[model samples]
Target: MRVTLYLRCRGIAPGTVDLVSTGLKTDHRGILVFTLPDNHPETLRLGTNDLTALNPEGRVPILLLPDGRKMTQSGPIIDLIESTLAPDDDITLLPTDPWIRAEVQRIMWIIAADTQPYQNIPFIIQAMGEWGMVKDNPTRHPLRLHFIRREFGAIENLLTRCAGKFAVGDSVTLADCFLVPQIRNALLAEIDLPSEFPILSTVWNNLLDVPAIRAVLDDAGGIVQPLVYDAEQFEVYNG
Candidate 1:
């Protein structure tokens, strides 16, 4: 049976398509980008294309068969990614190289959690929405830039600590893909790409050269926020 994956290319629901795309990249993911980049010019494919009725939170799972019957098994994405791991990839209580893996995990935690918690971002946005209001007289408050800049600064420090071409280990892992998007988002929030955080600038400039990211972009669909971000606003936001 073919696997169907739901992906959002943008925001905190922040689907770092890299992890998911690993399937497609390695012919592991049976799914395809719904819209080709040329046709759909949005960076993050942020929409409700895939909504399964038997969600994990529901306790009862629903599994949809090719024949069209629904049996409950709502953990499809995890199943899909797990299926893609190589022969060496195994689930263990501890890795053979515990120290190395621990460091890697630490970096991953910061990047995944502290760097940009895409998962909990909605709550932040929801809170911001409640805390502030938008009206015709003033669409947004200038202070928002400062709030975002602080966030970007945190990421910059993380990136700077790992300031090599990519994030985390010498090889690309879960961290690089995320750091890349967070930097891109910082730009979208009008955070300066360079001056505000030179370390981030150095790391980011280096990330631009990574082949995996470039390859991912080639396959990525829609208009990316990074591709259209404004420089001054980016500076003000990151600055």
Candidate 2:
């Protein structure tokens, strides 16, 4: 099946959701990726684009299915990918056991719902403006750090009970897809993961070694690029 993903170009500060989508593509393969302009999301927010037509929320990581349907929001998009996987597929983003599945979802949500949204660029830009602070204000670092550290701390504590080589187990799951990117964000914020959250640090290190995860990082030059598509120029990977 052909799938098209719309996302932003991978740069110094990559989008969190974009990484999740890219990680999935690395595992699932046969996905066509289109890199969007960096300003694409800002255009939607500034009333300059019709991105809302595809996604009411105006977010990236929009997945266009082969059947001409579109899926938005990373969590639901991940769900769609998991649902469509054949039983014999080599990679299982979501585990089969009920308890393990819940554990996986738990980590995914902590990053997706609790961590990423709060520290996202758009939100941080607006927040700094509201406080009448300059873009490079020293205080801004703490704001981003607070959210990352808080969430990482909680996940660290949980990891003691659930983690193995990865977030929840030895194999990569949806949680790791959601996690590695967040760890990148933390590093961008200057938070020392190994120093603060040892368990997460170990998992982050292990995740980097996985081929799917490593390829995603290497392809983006240590981050992830967005998906913007042109019918003629799209690249297809059938992993």
C-alpha RMSD for every candidate: 11.9, 12.1
- The 10-residue segment with the lowest total lDDT in model 1: 22-31
Candidate 2 lands at a TM-score of: 0.70
Q: Estimate each model's TM-score.
A: 0.48, 0.70
Kindly state the number of residue pairs that clash in model 1: 22
Question: What lDDT score is found at residue 165 in candidate 2?
Answer: 95
**lDDT score of residue 192 within candidate 2:** 74
Candidate 2 clashing pairs? 7-226, 7-227, 8-226, 10-225, 30-237, 30-238, 34-227, 34-228, 35-228
Candidate No. with top TM-score: 2
For each predicted model, how many residue pairs clash, with residues at least 3 apart or on different chains?
Answer: 22, 9
Off by over 4 Å in 2: 1-49, 131-140, 223-239
